[model samples]
Target: MDLSSLRFAHRFDQVSGSAIREIFKIIARPGMISFAGGNPSLAALPDEKVSELSVQVLRDHGKQLLQYGATEGYPPFLESLKQYVETAVGFRPDAVLPVTGSTQAMDLLCKALIDPGDTILVENPSFLGNLQCMKLYQANLVPVASDDDGMDPADLEEKIKAYHPKMVYTIPTFQNPSGRTLSLARREKVAALAAEYGVVIAEDDPYRDLRYRGEMLPSIKSFDREGWVVFLGSFSKIISPGLRVGYLAGREEIIRKCTVGKQSTDVHTANLTQAIVDQFIRQNLLPDHIRTICADYGEKLARMLGHLEDLAGLVTFTRPEGGLFVWAELPEGLNALELLKKAIDQGVAYVPGTHFFVDGGHENTLRLNFSNSTDDQIDRGMSVLKTIFREAK
Candidate 1:
């Protein structure tokens, strides 16, 4: 028999590789100005600080870190992480499980809760990575309608009633791709709805600390009295994504299930990285670090938005207070997927927004990232994009 005749899992039949990752391959050429990934700025990664922390942790706990650790978490990280979650994240979790990254956190949650054909209510243009994760679990992803204030409560309730979904995944703050934050009222409403309908709310809030202009809002899990909301957090944006340290916080039972699931996943998040992040929390390093990141990213965001303002009538975009991305919709009949080819030719790139949608039809929309690029890159890249969009219009 030919090896090409092998059968793979049926769950992957409808799924494909990440569109953003595929775009990355195209944009890897020298001089490409990419606005595709939700990457932290290179300058913001705190390399010197991480190096110092890594040395201190290794010297102090060399043997312990090298040894296999528990699936639940690194014990010291668990202590500091819980306190950080309470103070910085504004939620007191019943339990917390440290994962390799928030991406793994999402996978663990899906593994724990979802069976094939289970329903998951998602924001229409949700995070593509997680959308792909849900699909890998063979989930029926139902889109809940959203506006500038983020996911609408009324529609969310209606979807919950109609679908009776096992989980309702939301970014809630500085949402991925869209950069729209959920309103405070809707946050409370979502928490209440989760409790009322017995549905799980996956509050994935990696960019909450990256705010530029607005007052901070409470996490959806803060209002979750019945422990229905699971807060997924990451240090990727504020710290370093290379470290791959993130956590899941929620009810003990839910966390326990994820812990068991994680055991078969990676055994545990790398203990060395966990210790470094634990020290970041314990030494109170995040506040000053986050402030530095905000100031720089805020300027980049402003510069990009200023460029977008030049096409006011021809393009409409979300004005996010914080986050890496700005979502834009070109005039109707203008396709962003087609525009991307022209953009790459001009040495610029952005992810088409249709890739973020569950059903994939919004061709006019595109997602731009400012955090990873320099001021000159934003000016030049946006200039290239502006010209392309204007000519297309």
Candidate 2:
């Protein structure tokens, strides 16, 4: 019998691979100015500091870091991370589990809570990666409507009544692809709604620390009165994506279930990276480091916005207070997917906003990341996009 005749799991039936990864392959050509990924600026990575921290952690805890670690977390990191969450992140976590990245936190949450056909309410144009994660778990993803203030709580409550969803997933601060933040009032309402409806809220907030302007808002989890909210955080944006240190914080029971699920996943996040991040917190290195990165990224964001402003009536884009991406809408009937072919040919690339939608038919929009592009690159890439959209229109 041919092995090619084998049938795969039904969980994959509705799922296709990431569209962004496919775009990455096309833009890999030399001279491509990619606005396609949510990567931290190269200057923000702090290589020498990481090297110094690595050596220090190794000297202090070499044997344990080298040996097998707990599925819960590396010991020092667990302690430091909990303190950091309470003080810096503004929540008192009952339990916390350090995972490979916040990406894994999504996977483990789905594993812990989802069953085939279970409903998960999400923002209409939400983070694609977690949407795919829910699909892989055979979820019924229901789209909740959103405005500039982020997901509307009235719409969310209506969905909760209708769908009786198993979970509600949101990127409440500096949302992915759209760069919108949930308002303080809505944040409080969402937490209240979750408790009232007895639903789980997965507050994935990796980009919270990346804000370049305005006052910092409290997390949705901070307003959570019940055990219904879980906060997922990532060090990838602030430190190095290569380090892959991220965490899940929540009620002990829910966290325990994720911990059980994680045991079969990667077992635990790498000890070396956890220790390095631990030192970052214990030594109080993040405040100054974050300030430095914010300054550089702020300039880049301003440059990209300037280019977008030049587009004027031809297009409309979000003026995000802070975050890596700016969402843009081309004129109706001018398809971003179709325009991307012309853009790649012109040495520019971006993710079509259609892919971010739960039901996938908003062809007029696209997402552009400013953090990964330089002043010159943003100028060149946006010029290419403007030319393509103008000619297409």
Q: 1-393 in candidate 2: lDDT tens per residue? A: 999999999999988866778898987788899999898989899999999999998998999999989999998899999999999999899999999989999999999999999999999899988999999999999999998999999999999999999999999988888999999999999999999999999999999998899999999999998889999999999988999999999999999999999999988899999999999999999999999989888889899989889889989988888878999999899899989998998889999999999899999999999998888999888888878888898
User: Which portions of model 1 show Cα errors greater than 4 Å?
Assistant: none
What TM-score against the true fold does each predicted structure earn?
Answer: 0.99, 0.98
Ten contiguous residues minimizing lDDT sum, candidate 2: 13-22
Pull out the clashing pairs in model 2. Answer: none
Tens digit of per-residue lDDT, candidate 1, span 1-393: 998999999999879875667798987889999898888888998999999998999999999999999998999999999999999988888999999999999999999999999999999899988999999999999999999999999999999999889999999987888989999999999999999999999999999999999799999999999999999999998899999999999999999999999989999999999999999999999999999999999999999999999999999999999989999999889999999999999999999999999999999999999999999999999999989998997
Q: Which ten residues in a row have the lowest lDDT in candidate 1?
A: 13-22
Angstrom error of the Cα, residue 18, model 2: value is 5.4
lDDT of each: 0.94, 0.93
Supply candidate 1's per-residue lDDT for 292.
94
* TM-score, prediction 2: 0.98
Off by over 4 Å in 2: none
